[model samples]
Target: MAEKTLAGKTVEVTGEGYLVNKEDWSKEIAAELAKEDGIDLTEKHYEVLDYLRKEQAAGTTLTIRKVGKSGITDIKGLYQLFPGGPLKLSSKYAGIPKPASCV
Candidate 1:
């Protein structure tokens, strides 16, 4: 495990910088994480993040297509919101472990 300060709180994370304990996440931390990826979070982005966290808590198998059908955005929009990586980046910002689908 590794640690990083987010939102002035030092939280545990994985090697790739994903939060190990989702409980440690906050909107401020999410904003900071998105900043690192050059993304500026908006209400829509928060909706997507909330969706991801909910799905993760339910142990759902996360995928771009699944997120697309989430009514938040389509596949193209997900790509646009996250650029190079949709699912991976979203999961990371959502403070969940990197999904196996990534890479």
Candidate 2:
């Protein structure tokens, strides 16, 4: 685990940077995380992140295939929106646990 400050608040995170405590999350933290990844959050990005957060909160397993069915973005669109590791990056920004499908 590791601790970092974002928006003047300290939060713990996994070594891979997933939030350790979901309750420590905030839109400010999401913005900060996105900036670090060189992503400028737009409505499209929020659509995916918001959906991921809601799904995780409901204890649903997150997967690339599942995200595609979300109607927010298809697999290709999600990759284009997040780049690199789409699910990993979006999940982190959403402040949810790293999806089991990740890594």
Candidate 3:
């Protein structure tokens, strides 16, 4: 784990930049993370983030197909919203570990 400052608070994160402690997450931190990723975090983005966080807390592994079925957004929309790596980037901003399926 590595330490980083976010939303004016110190938090633990993995080497890949995923949050180590889910409790350390906040909307402010999400906003900062999104900014770093070049995302503006619209309501549609929040919908996916909310879904990802909830699924993560429930021990569900995240995937682009799953996210598409989430009713938050479709696969194309997700890619458009997150650009490069949708699930990975969204999970990072949502403060969850990198899903095993990511790589």
Candidate 4:
């Protein structure tokens, strides 16, 4: 896992590839998080993140195939964006506050 300072706090990567902290975040924080991952928070990214978060919250898991079905075509391209793959990257980078088992 990787660690970095974001917004003056320590952001630690968890098993799911997301930075976990004891703070609740707003939409702006989510955008800032995407920037940390070098991902531009476009509509597509936001949509996917939103869906993934909702799914995780609802006790479901996602996969690259699901991501592609969600309207993202370039799974291979995401390798550079998220070395741990879409599940980790999206779950982590989206700042979804949930446990891996919850998904």
Which number leads on TM-score?
Answer: 1
Name the runs in model 3 displaced over 4 angstroms. none
1-103 per-residue lDDT for model 4 (tens digits)? 6776665656675654455653444456667676766776666666667777777677667666566666554666555445545666666656765444434
lDDT of 1 by residue, 1-103 (tens): 9889988999998888899898998999999999988999888888899999999899999999999999999999898888889999999999888999898
How well does each candidate superpose onto the true structure, as a TM-score? Answer: 0.96, 0.94, 0.94, 0.58
Q: Rank the candidates by lDDT, best first.
A: 1, 2, 3, 4
- Distance from true position, residue 43, model 4, in Å? 1.2
Tell me the lDDT of candidate 2.
0.91
Worst 10 residues of 4 by lDDT: 17-26
- lDDT at residue 84 of model 4 (Cα atoms): 48
TM-score of 1: 0.96
lDDT digits (tens) for residues 65-94 of candidate 3:
999998878899999999999988999999
Q: How many clashing residue pairs appear in each of the predictions shown?
A: 0, 0, 0, 1
Q: Report the alpha-carbon TM-score of model 3 versus the true structure.
A: 0.94
Worst 10 residues of 3 by lDDT: 36-45
lDDT of 1 at 77: 89
Candidate 4 regions exceeding 4 Å error are: 1-23, 71-84, 97-103
Model 2 regions more than 4 Å off: none
Candidate 3 — what's its lDDT? Answer: 0.89
CA RMSD, predictions in order = 0.8, 0.9, 1.0, 4.9
